[model samples]
Target: MSKISAYILFLSLFLLAACDSAKKEFETLKEGEILLDINTEEYSLNGTVLGKTATDISVIDDVIDKPLYKELCDTRGKFLEEALGNGESIDIFELAKLHVDDNLSYVDFYKALSSMYFCGYSDFNIAIGTNYKDVFQLSIPRTDYMWCGLVIQRMKGLRYKYLRNRQKLSLSEMSEIDVEDRECVEEYKGLDLLLSFYRKDDGIAYVVSLNETFFNKGSRFDGYNFYTFNNDADLWKFIEDIRSKVDRQIGNMPGKKEDKVLRLLANAHGPNKVMLVFQKDVLMKDIAPIVKKLNTYGYRFAFDLD
Candidate 1:
């Protein structure tokens, strides 16, 4: 055979082998689960990883090596010590608010953390320890709505804090309760608040729900159009103002109407965009008219998922 012919034959054989290997890998994946091709230039989801396929289930080495979990754990530990103190009697929810005000990044704190947990990069168990519920409340904060509950419960082992509404808490009275009790009472009042952090042998996850009432108290509107520019401050201010508006509107609405409205607004924004987080199951149908009113007032708007 000619030298060129031999070279061609070798190349064909190599291609055939590669094709066989790829096919075998593709066949091993399951439905619902996606296979990420981290080895290639494109991180394509070649096939399902969970439900059914032939791709072998193997952890991505690079994903396993992400230091985000460690960084988050360290940050949380420091935050806990500094904010709550070692044996200091302080409010957990308030501390969370303080952290949000002081250290949280505006671009993607919640979404990035959620992704890290979902991707198996962090150990949620170690990150949370005994404070899982409190962490969850602080992470998400809207538990009163039904839809928000669906999102929260889908993550792992998480429950919304429940607070019965009969107590009629004043603002100062509510603020003074211990973090855990405050979250519990808030939940019972048809307000869902959660803070979740979980870890297992493979990875870690952190989720928080912000108290809409508390968040709104700190938020303001600077009169920027929501449809244009997407100014960070303006966006945050609008959200804050919306929270206040929702609370007032809830007073007039009947039959769990308030929780529903809060949920819809919470679901509309991505983690970074969400200055306030709520429970997963709350209904949010009534807030549309209010949002329209804001739009009429010249607050431009856009929705983003982070």
Candidate 2:
């Protein structure tokens, strides 16, 4: 084939591929359904979906309930006893202190629990609490009692500040728009750790803003990112990959720092409708483990090239 003919053929293929990519199907879920229901018997514990649509997913078990807490406490105490040896002076308070002092990453903390069977493969539950006293809260318990509460407290305050600042920006932008002859009041909706809503004078609903910690570095409280969509099935599939890798690494001992970082980035950006920009070369391999792990969680993994 002539050079021009070959070039035309390649271009046609590329355009067809692009058109195919643009077409995506969305699935809706009703409330109280298990967004990522994993049958422990059929699936590996390491594999679990991270995201669930509010309408479709059901609650498998509330790991935060009192009974679960008690079980965890008893198991953790036993592990500590063995680690410290028989009759070595140790208390829960002291153990908590050590966890805080070390500033251990999630990987290290998970390893500590798994080593003693105090904890097993589990997805880190990320909850957004109601606004109270003008503060937003995001709470995820520490597998280790000593530092988990403190860490959560600090994270809640930081998340509040980040969301509040972003809201201010959104409101300011709305105000600058011309509304000389139109209604000018801003209707504020409830706020949460993950999302805030607002209605403008023009009757357009706006998503106030998501927490900034997911994208910003040097924000001491930076950990994971939360993405929202009209549909959550695809997002959850991606999340399962991350959860699987995290669980597998912790089980193996000596979890890698890179894994944690990549998981954070993917969790924060993967579900967004917009394109994500990052230091690709630096985060490339770090992201691979997460993608590989997602398969165990039962998600058909695919990249959003668009």
Candidate 3:
């Protein structure tokens, strides 16, 4: 074919393909759904028809809006007193220390922690340790980004739960928003679960690849541990095995070393960190349960924010 004719043919094919793509996108969008084409890399969007796109977004640490904070305190004031001293004035962390066990159950302590976290005290921290109160100091270690990130995500969840009820958005509309829950904060039982299972010197990070059919487990970034789980039961079993080994190791340690190990485990950068590798297409509904389970073990979750 002549050059001019070949160029014209290529243009026609390009237009045809573009039209086909547009048709597919249009078909997937429902009547009430609006399509957005965003180029900035600061926002991540998850939707059924639009597909999923993740970006390098920092967790928003904005204090809960005053009106909503007031609403929360008003309705849950009695519950709030469990953590906040006198239900109003006092350093919350100091107050938490006083009731570390006297008045607070593990569950209740976490509830108070969540209240304080959402109430603008983002410095509060937790970790896998014997004394949970020791980890609740105002000076959270700078290395504990995973724990901080989890709280931020939990706050995001709470904001959605509270505000959505007020806006009265339809179920269909609500589904589009990725509302990770506040449960991870309140439901965390790291101290109760005895999750200090790794040797303090080992420095192992459990990075799990959440696949479609199974989970790929890795102890180091160098390679996978060759352990794949087709079910949650197997994953729990593997963790138990690690715990058993840790117990044996601790039994053999000198008393001084054992004490040192305990102190090390309480630090935020300790062995209780897990990096969950998720495919972009994975839904938050599927991710939430696993996250909650991990939180129960006092496992701080890290993600590929990049």
Best by lDDT: 3
Q: What local distance difference test score does each model get? A: 0.32, 0.30, 0.35
**What lDDT would candidate 1 get against the real structure?**
0.32
Writing each residue's lDDT as its tens digit, candidate 3 over 160-191 gives 22221132222223234532433333332231
TM-score of each: 0.21, 0.21, 0.30
Candidate No. with top TM-score:
3
lDDT of 1 by residue, 1-306 (tens): 999999999999997787666445433533222222221111223331122111211221232223433433444455456656556533431221111111212222333334334333222211111111221221223235465344333321222222211222243333443222333233322223222222335543333333344333333311111121123355446545555564554444444756776555543332122222222211122223322333353332321122
- The global Cα lDDT (0 to 1) of model 2 is 0.30
Residue pairs whose backbone atoms clash in candidate 3: none
Candidates ranked, most accurate by lDDT first? 3, 1, 2
Regions of candidate 2 where Cα sits further than 4 Å from its true position: 1-64, 86-306
1-306: candidate 2 lDDT, tens digit per residue? 999999999999997676444321101222211111122112111123323212111222221323323444554456566757765544332222001011212222222223222333122221111111111111122355344334332332333333321333333332344222112222211111233222245532212233343233333321324443232355555444444544443345434876776655444433321211112112222333333333344322211110
Better-scoring candidate (TM-score), 2 or 3: 3
